[model samples]
Target: MRITTRRRLTRAGMYVLFFAVLAVVILVTDWGRLAQQFFQLDIARDQFPEIITIALKNTILFTLISFVGGLVLGIVFALMKLSSVAPYRWFATAYIELFRGLPALLTIFAMAYMVPIALGFRVPGGQVGAGLIGLILVASAYMAEVIRSGIQAVPKGQAEAARSLGMSPTRTMGWIVLPQGFRIIIPPLTNEFVLLLKDTSLLFIAGSTVLTKELTTFARDGLTNTGNGTTLVMAAMLYLLITIPLTRLVAVLERRLARGR
Candidate 1:
């Protein structure tokens, strides 16, 4: 009859229903078939050493290369976006808008295949390199906005105070504004890194040799060779192993930043 008693009864009923469904699923599911398809010990074993040495190594390498390249380009565009010169602003806006609006896969495909045919330009590392360049372009567009916002969030007073002390605008921005902006944007930038790490999987569309294969491509190779899905599962687990900690770090940094504010 009481409100608290009714709430408790509702909660109890929900738990019962949840367990009933879970029990039914467990009873009806064929775990042996699932294991054969996705958890075969021999297939998983075959992926060892090479998966770690080649696949995961390539994934991390591509991510670092893309992030560094993207960060440099993003900083340039972010500054251009904030420039008083209209042409600089226009160019920056166009670049950011164009790349961000396009799918990353399409962009990578264009770089890997279309650019070579259209312009006869061979990116330094072949198709893999072209894919990396595409990723950098896409990443720079997103990061430019993040950097620009971070720069704008820095207090105007800070800049004014520096200017009053006879510091040049460039000097003030370099010495004062940028460091503060970077600190403010660290969490978002880290979040971006995690996203980019996962985005390396898209490079598979550009294709790879056994040597150049990153995680997704390597898993596909494993799938083909073994005819079991265990390699896919292994690759997924490795990805989670890398990403989970970074994601948790992002959350921690955000909370700390909020508390500081």
Candidate 2:
């Protein structure tokens, strides 16, 4: 009882210290100015719709395209990495490491300027098209790692069992390993989608026409028009609105996967 009492006192002291620090910070900072800039009501209403239409839409579009592209390419990369052939594994590993190490913005810039110049070809939607391709490349690297791990997580016995049942190597992998691996990958893949949604903001660096401008760009334009920061806040809120649901979905998937395991 005495030890318990002492522990309670220590906990209470930590809380008091935290509150004291918070009070000092509040007193030292310009709370009124921060509130006025970030929480201006009329400005939020004026800019929020535009933020939603441009930023939210583009973010969703980028994530969907990148997720689809990554899913397809990641599966192939994972298979290559798992292959018995030396060159396939080497090529897959090199591809994954190269894109994973590079910044998404640099990749987008290359796709926008360097690729087009080198190839002497126009990307269909100009900067937007280039940005999406860049996102797909970067996303594929990380997704490849996720998929490789998932495929590896499957029991070796499952492959042997399939082969014993007269399944060819390709058939065994297609029928047994991939389905189980995909189930294990679902939660992490959803998390990757959430990350991709946030990363779409980097597209602004590649530049876009007004119609193609995403959330950050749209908010910046709104800020310039209204001379207020409310647009930025609105953009943040809309991103949260979309991402929060996906995050919750990820949690549910994790629980389901855990239970299945």
Q: What is the C-alpha lDDT of each candidate?
A: 0.94, 0.88
114-159 per-residue lDDT for model 2 (tens digits): 9999999989878788888999999999999999998899999999
Give the 10-residue window scoring lowest on summed lDDT in candidate 2. Answer: 46-55
In candidate 2 the C-alpha lDDT for residue 95 amounts to: 96
At residue 151, give the lDDT of candidate 2.
83
TM-score to true structure, per model? 0.95, 0.92
How good is model 1 by TM-score? 0.95
Please write out the lDDT profile of model 1 over residues 1-261, one tens digit for every residue.
Answer: 999999999999999999999999999999999989999887787777999999999999999999999999999999999999999999999999999999999999999999999997788999999999999999999999999999999999999999999999999999999999999999889988998999999999898998999998999888898888999999999999999999899899899989999
Window of ten residues with lowest summed lDDT in model 1 = 39-48
